[model samples]
Target: MTLKPLADRVVVKMVESEETTKSGIVLPGSAKEKPQMAEVIAVGPGTVVDGKEVKMEVKVGDKVIISKYAGTEVKFDGQEYTILKQSDILAIVE
Candidate 1:
């Protein structure tokens, strides 16, 4: 099965967070913070809302930073994904 987002929405998979700090200390899972970065898996076509056209800036395979608490989490076929509006995406990582 595949995930296809609707207008103005995007689907992404979270990038794994680092398990060790700069000092080479291995942190436990309980001490790790959720990663803000993700890789774009799918993008929705532009949408029209309130008489304005909202174009999607991100595309598949683009790495980006998402809002701290944005998007809904989904589990499919043993993999996890997040579906959110384009607006919820903060910046693209080059």
Candidate 2:
């Protein structure tokens, strides 16, 4: 199943954090924190500002690093997706 964001919303697939510690010690499954970095899966066309449509800054396939505590988490059809405003994006990864 495919999902699309609406308005100024964006969808990101979170990238998994480190599986092992710096000492090369493998961490347990339950020890991982949700990564803040993710790849942009889809994006809304644009947002309306002052009755004018503004183009989105990021595009599909752009890797982004977001804030640790940002956006709303949503699940659809057993798949997880993050719904964040375009302004919530911290930076675009090269």
lDDT of each prediction vs. the true structure?
0.92, 0.84
- Model 2 agreement with the true structure over 5-86: per-residue lDDT tens digits: 8888899978776576788999764577768788898998788989988779999899899887688888888878788988
> Tens digit of lDDT per residue, candidate 1, span 3-79?
98999999999987657679999886557788888999999997999999998889899999999889999998999
Q: Which stretches of candidate 1 lie over 4 Å from their true place?
A: 19-30
Residue 90 lDDT (model 2): 93
Please give the distance, in angstroms, between residue 51's alpha carbon in candidate 2 and its true position after superposition: 5.2
The superposed Cα distance between candidate 1 and the true structure at residue 3, in angstroms, equals 0.7
Structural similarity to truth (TM-score) of each candidate: 0.86, 0.76
lDDT of 1 at 4: 83
- The total of clashing pairs for model 1 equals 0
Full-model lDDT, candidate 1: 0.92
What overall lDDT, based on C-alpha atoms, would model 2 receive against the true structure? 0.84
